[model samples]
Target: MKPESALVLEELRSKLRPASVAQVGGFRPGADPLTSWFLKGVCLPGEGLPVWKGQPMFPLIQIRTDELPVIPEQLKGIALLVLFHNREHHPFDQPHGEGWLIREYATLEGLELLPELETPYHPFPVRWVSVNDDAPGWEDAWDIIDLSEVNDDTQASDSFFDDFNRYGGTKVGGYPMEIQHSVGIKDFVFQVGSEEKVNWMWADNGIGYFHRSAEGIWQFSCQFY
Candidate 1:
């Protein structure tokens, strides 16, 4: 009966313990918090709006496997496996059967296969994939990638709500951008468990909360303070 989004968060936190991680800033409540800032660099300049060049919108959680204080039990085995099969094998990319299959799926579908709620009018479709015998460890890989980004030092902009209050904002020396309620950092919540309690209580004070949406996608919402 737990909310699906909370489950996702807990799973990652547990697995990546002792790793210094933080959530990048930029997610404003109702905004698409998970939207990757990397997309800005991908787009050509002068074609669209210049990327938000402000401080990173998200936290920086860098992990050096060699430096971890307490590596996950399963990961140790994985490292050993890589050590034994250095030339032909890779983490999650065994040269043989299902490992290879899952690796291929991860490369081609992992991002799209997030366990999320369905949505309409989104830039991308929200679909959930179950992990069963056929796919044993795929979820773990995604969890690592996601949790590694959560950090205590990352900071978000207070201007998000201000921008929304005004209904728009102009990028520094750039074109004007319209901020909408549906996309602003309001009207959103990140709660956990069957009771659906907010992960970050006092929604107006903390950085934000994250929860699986009614449609199943992992969504982030900012507090109002």
Candidate 2:
């Protein structure tokens, strides 16, 4: 944890009800990986209110990739936006794919809350798309323009959570770098598997890959945008 995050966690303990914190993100089929990617921006107080016991809960919102509003001017040139989620039962391990798909869809739906910045500037647009290992042809892959070069370091710290917490209860600390903006789609691919085996894509830098492992685990991998 970063020094700043520790301070925030301490503060959360002071202000909100006590709750357990669990890691949420992609995991390998059978064994748990050392590090799990997380949803960075969304946070909640108490697990029940959101009806889900996961960290970095995704709020109900609608998103359409084909018709995204103008990138929020504020985040226009930012490098990355990390997102998080709470742990859940292994979907693939279960019998039918229905339960797993529903849960996974909910997580993706919750992602909408993270990009709710002043209109015309969102971190990146994401959606479910087919993916394979061969280098994606233009029509086959999604395009994520790089803005890391244009971002101003001073403004990077300007967080939406600061305002998000004002309406809902606040968490003590902010997002972790691993969950925030550090990891990207590439990292997720290496962690999970490549397109030949996986069935997802890297939208911008975030994880949005989908595939199943030979061991029978239904897997979906992604990082924050």
Which residue segments of model 2 deviate by more than 4 Å?
1-50, 54-56, 59-62, 65-84, 87-134, 137-206, 211-218, 222-225
Model 1 segments beyond 4 Å from truth? Answer: 1-20, 23-206, 213-216
Question: All predictions: root-mean-square deviation over Cα?
Answer: 22.0, 20.9
The candidate that wins on TM-score is: 2
Cα shift from native, residue 157, model 1 (Å): 31
- lDDT per residue as tens, model 1, 1-225: 124434444453344212112122334322332222211111112222111222112111111122233333323321111001111212131232211111111111112212222221122111111111111022223423342232321221121112112211100110111211122222121111111121222232323223223442333332233
TM for every model, in the order presented, reads: 0.17, 0.18
User: lDDT tens digits, residues 102-169, model 2?
Assistant: 12221322232233222222222222222111121111112232223212322322321232222111
lDDT of 1 at 25: 31
Q: Which TM-score value belongs to model 2?
A: 0.18
lDDT score, candidate 2, position 86: 24
Stretch of 10 with least lDDT, candidate 2: 167-176
Instruction: State each model's CA lDDT, in order.
Output: 0.21, 0.25
Best by lDDT: 2
